[model samples]
Target: MRRREGGARTGRGVGVLRVVVVGLMVTLVGRLWFLQVVSGDRYVRAAAGVSVRTVALAPLRGQILDAAGRPLVANRTVPVVSVDGVALAHQADGGRAVLGRLAAALRQPYGRLAGKIRMCGPGVARPCWPGSPYEPIPVADAVPVQVALQITERQADFPGVTTELRPIRVYPYGRAAGHTLGYLQAGVGRDGLEAVYDRDLAGRPGRRVVAVDNAGNVTRVVGQDPATAGNSLVTSLDARIQVIAERALATALARTGGTSGAAVVLESATGRVAALAGYPGYDPSVWTGGVTAGQYAGLQLLSRAVQGQWAPGSTWKVASVAAAANAGYRLDARYGCPSGYTVGDRLFRNFGSADLGTMTMRGALVKSCDTVFYRIADELWRRGSDVPRRTATGFGFGARTGIDLPGEAVGAVPAASARPGDAANFAIGQGGVLVTPLQLARAYAALANGGTLYAPRVGERVVRPDGTTVRSIVPPVTGRLPASAATLAFIRGALSDVPRSGTASAAFKGFPFGRIAVAGKTGTAESAGHRDTSWFASFAPDPAYTVVVVLSEGGRGAQGAAPAARQIWEGIDGLRETR
Candidate 1:
């Protein structure tokens, strides 16, 4: 009976083992069927999605044209050599062998070619690419057509290399209007007009759908969305005038041995900038490919016309006269014009210390009598009036002119004070009073245009690729002069006589007043340790053009800055004659 029971237990155990094995076999078959039939399409779609990529093709940058439709900053097409980083990765030797072959063909070093395609990360330096690893990296831009064709035709020898047409900035006038025209770096504007209107100049980028293999190598282009070109910017700049202004500035620097300077030509009535020039100018093209921080800093790319802050010297007399007149001082009444005027412990002497006795405010302006204006400032200070500061602010001084450019300097104006020499210095545009060349031009423009102060306009309009108008740029009216029409008229008459018989007369000795009657002021402000700052601010009453020239560390406004203005005025006269 015991033997029979043991045999039954063994049989039962064997049966249970067989049942468990069958159950596992059924479960495996079910899982296999589910994978093959239920979710097969989903997995396949995911795998295909992993192999596709969409590339962004940058649009053709718009042209920056002058008022007469001449291009100051335009684009030129050139062949660009690029490498597919992903395809290079799939190469048998990790793209090294491919890059070596490419470097040999392109006349570049193997290391440089390899560096151009390397993904940028911590510890990686440029020449390294900056975007996604899948994007084609530009190895060389502006390559010759023959070299580009050689690489493209010999695809088997140089795998993953490509030649494409790319648009780049070209300055037709060279460095003529460098400051105003600005420049682009890697499709982004750096300063001036370029920075202000970058969005309008850089149009929408297009999409390019491409396919890649499992190894992340691009196989073929599938589809593309055509790019839309940017709208062209039309500026008020006259190309010829811009060239003339730059040439005149160069002449001034050479003649006066000035370290640096700025020049501006503005439409007095409309507030349109005709020509804006700056010294220590550079070719905008240098920023095309790339520039290191050291290289850029060494360029000294500041725009003195809009960014320079310097004392107006006697040029501040215009504002001072207005300030005094508006503060109830008589424009027709006579004031003392001594060789020097004392305030507290300081004595402010006239230029060359020559006194012309006593004269009206108008005569003081023509003579640029510092003592008379100093008295006006002293009186205003004694009365506790803010007329000087208010007049300066009203005339667009001690502040930005709100010109449509980046990096404009908001010049400083000291608060109202009775600190002895402070009022006298402030009245003569000395002490802490400061103004930019552009600001001075705008102020003179307002004086010439019946006291309508406008925010200087450089960009005139924006036009689409199809020649439709995007919008017209209208310079906003910033403010009106604080003085009355009679006070302004008297000031205008005095300024009109300045170039004819006053302080600037020597500089305008032979200037053709018959063709265009010119009016302006001459200023030579002391610049601390450096030489005096030379300034000449003038305008044509009839045609209404305001021209201002300033020379840093250049002595005598009548000697340095006025001559530059005269040269520019001569050129302008010629322009007017031709018209």
Candidate 2:
């Protein structure tokens, strides 16, 4: 009986021991579940707080080329110095002394570095800087490779400072055709063709998921996303021809005491814009790579020709003549500009303030008599605005040119408000109207090409990186001038007589360029402060080319703009003969 009692007590003690062991295992599993599943996101946050680091990869920018495949805007390998703003914050123990050390290493002004670092403040716990932790601070751009190498060698002391290979836009031709090529900023297109073709020019950016250690240091590259470089584009501008136009315009502007100037050369048959130049033209390289504050201020002051709308002066006469011819108006009809004619309530005065007795249509044009055009404008107004408006549209007036560039404007012509003064002013290229130098160039091309108004094309082609021809720009015939053969002949004869007998006669009297018959007209438009928009548009040798030059504030078309046109003709003829 005693042995049975002992056995029962032993079994109960063993059962208690088994239950305690099971309880211990259950407690351990519950604690593990609480620590892992309940707080998984929190642990991830802790890991990121200690070990995530980011890096940036840049893409290549496209090349801008001119006609004949010469590079106008190109990309060159350049060394740029930058710093991971976030990395510097904690690595340099709040980055206070890191700024001074970085200044010494970069050999830059200590104060400038300090100023930037302080502005960044402290990027700990959360960022105190303007951008995210991955954002880089541009310490300096386009540093010399050797200088960058030296800085990199001592990067241990500089902490987060880095040197990378960057592509920099280079303009080998200076400000040759700045108004057309435009500029780039922050790997993005800012103005002109650069802005218009930003997507094509700025290639795709690459990225990588880098592995970082507990100290927020990049331990490995991990994986990479490769980047592709931008393609190359060819424009219609010829650097050599552009140089000629710029030199001529500058000399003319200086001689005329003009505030601004512009010029363009177009192919008569194809309507290709050979060269388009503007003065007081800003250097394209300055705006693209980087510009000083003072240079930027100066650019702001002279940003006119690209955006300025001005009275086209005598250049508008081309559109008027086209309109007149299109309307089948008598070209040889005699008209009188006796002192001045009355239009509406305004008494319009002749340019010379002298009476031009009854003269034929040809005589009216050669003499540039305000009275002749006045009567013509009145006739058009009487014929209804349709004839004139249609004529202007045919000539590409008041229409924005679809050039492969940004920030272009189509100047205005009078709407059918039917004001009498506008009619008279219309005859004189005044009232609510304006035209760009480019428009005059293209219209003159039509006159040279027997009245086939072709669209103005600027780019030649864009070659992809894979060696495929991506695009080739071709100009299209937009409109035609419907006129009698007799009227056309009469108008052509008068235009030829311009250099032969009119105001431009004195300027081109010598005919130094030889038997290349050139027909042109000169204009002087009135502006504020006695400033004038002087103009000269012409076509030479019929089958060859047409050149148009318009100057603003450039004294007189007779003494100012005309002489420049002559020089341009001389240069063009000389170059052609030599070639």
Candidate 3:
């Protein structure tokens, strides 16, 4: 009986054990099923996140070429040394030994190199890295081939250090047209053509899918999309002409003791800028790797060609001449060449207060007789004629030239409610009248091209890397001047005599007028507290090109600016030796 009772208790214990084991097995199987079917993709993605990384591949920037296909701003490949921040941080001594080794190989100070690798943040000064801490930091640019080879050859000593061939901007002309060509700061456009055409110049960036281990070491390149280089920019700037203009401007600035100046050469027919030069220039190469704020502020970064606004002076007389003709003043009519003209209790004196005998309207222009223009302006104001303002606007003043470059200044013009004195000043390009060198150039270009005013363009076309044309850039004709063919021809004939027997005659005393007939005007404007602003606006009468020069604090148009214009014309006509 006892044995039977013991056997029954053992059977019950075994049965209860079996039931508990079976329930445990069922829970384990259900959990495994849920994990495999419901959450499998989530875990897989998490796994991928740990091992895969995507890196951006920067595309090569395009080249800037001249009209003759010569490189103005170009690129060259150089070895750049870089250090991976994450890998360096994982070092036993926190990258000190590795950086020291790298510094020795690079012949750079260890402290300077370390400062460059440090991620920029609060309390950190620059030369500090401004990019992501996970990526490699470029510590050295344009490193020597030998130094780059040494570091790469000994990877164990310089862990995480790498040498890569990267393209950097090289100015073949060296500061020639620096302001117009613009520059790149840390691979981003800052001004001029670089900023305006940044999108087209900067092609699409590619991607690289890389695999890394737990220690963030790149194991393999999973996939890559090759970067597409930017399209090349073809500009209308003639390098030879640009050099000539620049040299001529420098000579003028030095000879006249002027502080600043600008010169523009434009193709009258197409309105293409051949040469645009500004004095007190700087080297664009200073912005290769990067530029400091202090360094940038100290540099003469302003492009006086498009950004400078000055009194048009007597160069404004041509527009006035057109206005007078439109107001029923006959071109052949005689106007007095008095010493001064009185208006509203104030006497507007001619330049040097000279009194000459009466002459025809054409002869007054030839002598640049200020009293004559002042009288005409007063008469127009008395009649309440809008011809002055209309002619000024039609000639492309008081508005931007719509150039492709950035930071263009829209000059000022007198309002409709101007007084007699104001009208006189406007006629002489003073008081409230202002015009940019570019605006004045465009105005003269319109006069040269027979009434068609263009918006002017520097870039001629965009081309692909394979030399295929992308698109031609043709600037539209903004408006038409109100001057008729007969009026234009008459004015042209008067201007033709300016360099030969007028105010600019002395400057062109020995110039070859027969070879290159230059039609122009000379102006010496008064400044309240500064020396007179000198101006000379001229164009070849055959209507091929127009050249304009202006000098601040320069004594007179004939003495300061006209000589430079002569030099440029000589160079343009390939008669530099003759002059």
Top candidate when judged by TM-score against the true structure: 1
Instruction: List the candidates ranked by lDDT, beginning with the highest.
Output: 3, 1, 2
Q: Which of candidates 1 and 2 is the stronger one according to lDDT?
A: 1
- Per-residue lDDT tens digits for candidate 2, residues 7-58, read 9999999999999999999999998888799977557757675444455566
Error of 2 at 422 (Å): 2.7
TM-score of each: 0.89, 0.83, 0.88
- Write the number of the candidate with greater TM-score, choosing between 1 and 3: 1
Candidate 2: lDDT of 332? Answer: 61
Residue 374 displacement in candidate 1 (angstroms): 1.5
What is candidate 2's CA lDDT for residue 57?
Answer: 60
Query: What does candidate 1's lDDT look like per residue over 1-579, in tens digits?
Result: 999999999999999999999989999988988887897865775777546788887799899999999999999988988888887777888878778877887787687677667787798876566776667787877888888999989899888888998887888999877888776564233787888899999999998887766767667888999999999999999999998999988898888889999999999999999999999999887776566545676885789999989998998888888888878888889899999988777888877898889898889989888889877787778778888898888888878888998899999889876577798899988999889999999988888889999999899999998889999999999899888899888988999888899888988998899888998899999988999999999998766799999999878888889989999999988988899
Q: 169, model 3: CA deviation in Å? A: 1.0
| Candidate with more favorable, higher TM-score: 2 or 3 | 3
lDDT (Cα, tens digit) per residue for candidate 3, span 209-249: 87776677776888999899998899999898899999999
Q: Which ranges of candidate 1 are over 4 A from the true structure?
A: 1-42, 45-50, 92-115, 121-127, 153-157, 186-189
CA-lDDT, candidates in order: 0.86, 0.73, 0.87
